[model samples]
Target chain A: MRKRDLSQFFKDKRVILLIILILASVISISTIGIQEGLDLKGGSLLQLQLEKPVDQDTMNVVTTVLDKRLNIYGVKDVKVRASGDQIVIVEMAGVTPEEIERLIGSPGKFEARIGNESAEPALTGSDITNVDMYEITGTSWTVPFKVSPSGAQHFAEAAEGKGGEKVYMYLDGKLIDENPPTLSPELANGKGATELTVTGGANTVEEAEAQAMAVYTVLKTGTLPVKLTVIGSNTISAELGEQFLNGAIIAGLLAILVISLIIFIRYRRPILVIPIIITSVSEVLIVMGIASIIHWNIDLSAIAGLIAAVGTGVDDQIIITDEVLGKNTDNTKRRKTRTRMSVKNALFIIFASAGTLIAAMLPLAYVGFARGSSGIGTISGFAFTTIIGVLVGIFITRPAFAKFLEIFIK
Target chain B: MLEKFMESYKLLIIIPMIVVILSVGLIAFNGLNEGIELKGGSIATIKLNEPIPSPVLENQLKTALNVDEVDILNNNGNDVTLEIGTEVNPASFASALSGKGQVISYNSIGPVLSDEALGQVYWAMLFAFIFMSITVFIIFREIVPSIAIILAAASDIIIAIGGMSLFNIPLSIASVGAILMLIGYSVDTDILLTTRVLRRREGKVVDRAKEAMKTGLTMSITAIASMVVLYAVTVIFIPQASTLSNIAAVLIFGLLADILTTWFMNLGMIRWYMEWRT
Candidate 1:
């Protein structure tokens, strides 16, 4: 052969040696399981964009409060972190959607009042409603509601003799302010509208409006001093989760069976299928087991990654099959050497491709840390498990592929 | 014999043309759907305290958000995924949900994130290209032959992306990953052809091309068979066509095109390059 016709990289049968390395890598990876994420295991992915651009201080306070609340729901593997601008992400394993709603719902409001005086309250704002606002004077307002009929009559009789005495308004039973005495008003048909006026407090229109809404919501829910609006809510049915889990298991098992058949048919030998099955199963199992050990929550995305890995493993096996068959071709003397060369080249491509994909997924998995992007933890888990599978494909499974190929072809 | 051989090579150029035409036509007629990731939108979660009647909250989400294009999915009984349309603004989305039920959490990915994603996609493609060029040169070590193979791979990628763009399969991060995968697959096939030809000495360049073509064609068909089956199952299992599915479609197309080009067009070019140099 002319000097120019020779491959620079092919000197000293380097390709054959590289094949051995590839086989070693695959075998090594087979012993280790890749880590899975929350998506694969089934968890909640919650994205919370702030209502307003709150400074870091408020966010810290909210985070602490939310963390405690999430922990209250038995979410031990919970991740609460900040995203870009004014968003927060929370991931918890085995979290039902209902639990998420409760955690993210608005804190409660509490208010209390008694005749001309009041006690502190412990009810939420949702219980309150029917707030009527009346203009008392220029730039002044009075708002009140007939406190749920029972409290109304009780306060009415309490004020019957206490006319000209100051009446106080309380939220969650805490005195908001006490209004100075007004003229004794005539009771219509011996009944009166239970009312209170913010005589000289509240400072601005916004404050007055807020106080009235809070008071109304509290009275409505009949519970507390806070008004809550669910910014985001999702409920995953246990039935659906179970179905998904079943589907994943079925799909996985079917894939294994199909791949095994493929190996047996192509190689025309049962022995060739053994290592492929072992390597494939080991890759997935080890990944899932490690994920459980790490307490990573698996979700839907992680399932997708798992399936993708399954397909990739089969593809790798096909390459091994080609090398094995190529090794035993026309020139038996060069079979070992050529088999090694083919495996090396194939592994090189697999490594490069897997590396590129891992790099891409890593940033996306972490994207949840930035505000706006959701599914951070779930994406991370999927990526993590995927990279693990690819690593095994390169390190353990592929090397084992070479060894197995060597055995079967011989 | 020579005429028969020339006829074999002609099919390579013809097949890719047919694929390009079909891909273009399909993408043109049936527009692609854009996911919320690329376009701005709101995805809200609704939690039912108890197992409510007709547990799927799609209706409630529509009523709460007052939008009909909402995707209300049953999550693991306590939660429903409410993927509302892009028509709703982030502030209004919060307000609308707040008006009805308490919002548990709401996420809005801005137009900027999509832009950044787009920028990142471009960067990835660029990196893949530069890396592929260097890797191909290093691995194959023949300038003209390496360039020929790279050109075929590049053509497959461009045509795939173009097909995706024309089809309006909203470019996504996941799709980018798929395109990279297609690249590796296409290049591998090309290298296989080059390897068989480079190692052959019993025949002319065209003869080697035909010999490689037989094996390359078989590999491509087998791979496509598996991919088609997988894609079918994926479609049936995941009715919602996500980015991953879109990538699968691209891969199938690119792989099919690659087989045609590598088994013939690439072979012709490499043969020509070798003959001219000598």
Candidate 2:
């Protein structure tokens, strides 16, 4: 090959575009960041199937109530949405599945009864306006709550003549406080006092704090409208999630290194191997960037899909390289014609294979979406990431690599 | 060089054909072992602060939890995986393990949902196969070559499944994704072989086949190399990535199977078709 203008080659639009895209992808990945799924980040995912099918409004109510309950539990990154007519999906980051089950598993019917256990509830969670923690002593705490106007009147009347009697608290038909607090004689004439306190039953400050917080959460967010059965739940520990993140990064880097070594050994030419490996690596980066921009969650399956995409990507690059550089016995004139034909043939196979791969993964993505929050939902992340990676390879990275090969390869 | 064996292509294809048939037979008779995700069950991984024997934990789980089916898998020396049937309660199950170790992760699925999931997985595989076959037929537009491509893809899946059964890898959603992906990977090399052998007329048939083999082998080797790295990393360093490890395992097996089905079986059919056409 004659001496080509290297600077002009750099000026080619495809190469310039490739460089710009790589830079943009790096920036996007650093700034926006890809979302990690529960598997990659320690969290909990719960799929709740309702007792009966409900309308859109009821579903909305359920979602709102659940969302409020999780928020009250101080789970900031909680997502609760209706999947179908009878299913609700709840996802919380940095929380255990057991914690989620405890918080939302029951209807949380919190009531405070006066006099006897069989007596009617003087104040329910719905009658409470606000719930807050109060320090009763050095290590003891109480959950003080303010009732609504009508509830305050009912409570005062119930406690008017029963100053020494106990005011019992029950949550879901089970008495939460074993030793109920007795009414004081200071306000015995039914003077409606809205503020009341539930004594904490714990030995340490931390335990009292936790008990107060649980009570506050239940009182703040009213009971769920319908019963929910947890059909599926997945929880990962924070330590394990961090380990997976680090391990995945190392594995990805090693995979790229090994793949580069293979290509180098096969081609035995830096000119061919460098572009191939660069294209493959760039494909991964661009996919991750797109994932970051779209806020797609990168779980283990998605990571697997990303690797699968790069694997096929390397395969396509090999095909292109072999097509352009494979030996031919024709004369110089026919050799030039053969190289051009081979590139075309290689592209045909690349596109055909790309089509088949996309076709194969289509059902995985579609079925996951169509099934709502069922079994395939978890696997959908893999399918979506794979499709995205393949599409990026065919549309952006592969064409750019072809352009580079055309400019550089002899 | 390969032309000498062209006459024996029929004989060479018989080996893989029998393996495929036996694989189908095994799957039909014994059936695939479904994972907890596929069938409704519970799986918990406990991280032991100290070392404990597997048998000790197993007996404790059985006695304390009263679970009918409990399998304790000792991963490394510190982590133990408990697989229990759906009869076990998730809350109590966690408490039962807490006495011995800290529960690192837990997954539970109800029977009704898992049944629905199983159905979805079957349909997904079926649809993926049909779609891939259609794409291959469209690309080739020839009956023999398209069938060869589809056959190779099918054989890869069947053999991969058989490998899974032999290796005791349970069929999960991750493995299902890998199998579907195998269809894609299998078709990739088959397309390259068919296109190079049937379309290009630069040299003798064997020479063209040999050239295709060089490129196809490189492609397969690179893919296999990457998967090997992935599998090794997951198995050795990252035990939490069990799902991805399963996927990598399936892909490695399928890719190896693809080499035989593509070069031996698909190549045989393509060579016969080319010779008959002339």
Q: Who wins the DockQ comparison?
A: 2
DockQ per model, Cα: 0.17, 0.81
Q: What is the TM-score of chain B alone in each candidate?
A: 0.70, 0.95
Candidate 2 recovers what fraction of true contacts?
0.83
Q: What docking class should model 2 receive?
A: high
- Give one digit per residue, the lDDT tens place, for model 1 in B128-197: 6676677777766788878877777777776676667665665555565556556656665677667666
Task: Please give, for residues B34-60, the per-residue lDDT of candidate 2 as tens digits.
Answer: 988779888888888887787777778
Clashing pairs in 2: none
Q: Can you tell me the DockQ of model 2? A: 0.81
Tell me the deviation in Å of residue A315 in model 1: 3.0
